[model samples]
Target: MALDRFALPARLRQSRHASLLLFAATLVLLLVAAAWFTSARSDLAEAYSHVGSRQQALTAANQRQQEAKLRVQLADSARSLVERASAGGFAENEWGERLINISQTPLARDEVNHLLAGMTRDHARIFGADVFELSVTRADEGLFDTPGSKGPPLMLNLRGTLLFRTAQSGSGVAAPVAALAAAPAIAPEAP
Candidate 1:
């Protein structure tokens, strides 16, 4: 039931200054902590803003890529030179190949001209393919018709050409070109 403070230091008993100083120091430390927290929050917000900006930029880039692909597709299907030829146009004479060749690949004007030019050059010596005599007619012409009786006879008549030059028959170095074979008869249409 009794408590005793047998000893006391006189300096501590008389001085309240030390306690006040300790309280002030604690307050300053709390202020410093608050300031640091505020600055850290601002930095976090800035980092998030940068991430959003980069995402927006990436989205815009993807949109541009899609648009480019669409333009390429449109170019392929429309207003192309090949499409024009398919829709009833003739190869330019300056560009036309004089002689035709059996081409397995899709024929371009350059290829056609190559075949024709080659034949034309070869003919000057033996084949005798006079360009002036070679007729340039409309899509609706007889020479182009495939030889009948040569296949399933049909009326669609995909008209083509009947080159009447000194006919090609593996000529020049090896195969002999046609020897003015009698009045180039129309091959009999298949019955």
Candidate 2:
């Protein structure tokens, strides 16, 4: 029923200096709050930018790691292929026959195709030969379609000249060119 209890005190309500001081302190507090907000927003933006850059760097590092792993796998595959060829009774710089046996399993199809593609694309480089020739034929007369056949269905025949490079006269230069030849045969092994 009475609003007098909520009224300002008489001395403070009548003082202009007190009112001006309160207004100035309020303005200062507002300015300080504005400055703090600006600083906090900028800091938050910088943190976000830093996180984005770090994420990009991490993605790049992961890609590089994956590429390195792929390279290692490719190198290992090449090494194993070369070792198998070497074990097939062919010596370096000699004309000899190499045999590769392929299985006709679904699991081996990709490997077989990859091997054929490599042999066709880089026969000379892969075999370290100067001259190379390749031929493919069916190993059996539709035996794969038969119920009893267990052998592979394809064969590859290769011919080439093998060349072994040698360091010449302690100079790191290659030796003079020489004649070379090589041959490879592929067939299905008995199951």
Candidate 3:
């Protein structure tokens, strides 16, 4: 009976050791699985973050493209407006209307005359002042009309010989057209 009791105690001790070893092995396996799963989940999250950033960058690029298109459209619109205004002869009409308004208004005659003379001088300077004879008249008076009736809207008729004296060019009118304009000289022009 003592021999049997001792064998039972040895058997119990061996069983307990086996159970402890089994538990340790199961715990090691569980730790390994948890580490692997955690690392894999972190990698997936990082990949998703990168994808989200790329999507945001693409959206910003699209917005920039749309803004560039809008800028181009605005530039085109401004260019078209300038072209239309230029084509409509806006400057000439404005000058004409302004002249008519000034003449009709009760402004000082001397002031108006001074303004006209200055404007004319400026115009002549722009034309290089190399003009031989500049005669302006309104509408077509035909190619072979009388001197008085022929020409476009004749605001003024200037006749002079251009002279370059001391490196400066000037038109020396022997007889002023305006001076002749006041005095009707029909005998000289008529047959």
**Candidate achieving the largest lDDT:** 2
Worst 10 residues of 3 by lDDT: 95-104
Q: Evaluate residue 119 in candidate 3 and report its C-alpha lDDT on the 0 to 100 scale.
A: 35
**Model 1 residue-pair collision total:** 11
- Name the 10 consecutive residues with the lowest summed lDDT in model 2: 176-185
Candidate 1's C-alpha runs over 4 A off are 1-18, 76-191
Candidate 1, run of 10 with poorest lDDT: 151-160
> How badly does each model clash, as a count of residue pairs?
11, 4, 7
Name the best candidate (by TM-score): 2
Task: Give candidate 2 misplaced runs (Cα > 4 Å).
Answer: 1-15, 91-191
**Model 1 whole-model lDDT (C-alpha atoms):** 0.44
The TM-score measured for candidate 2 stands at 0.43
| Deviation in Å, model 3, residue 157 alpha carbon | 34
lDDT per residue as tens, model 2, 53-95: 9999999999999999999999999888877765663334433
How high is each candidate's TM-score?
0.34, 0.43, 0.36
Between prediction 1 and prediction 3, the one with superior TM-score is 3
Per TM-score, what order, best first?
A: 2, 3, 1
Off by over 4 Å in 3: 1-14, 75-191
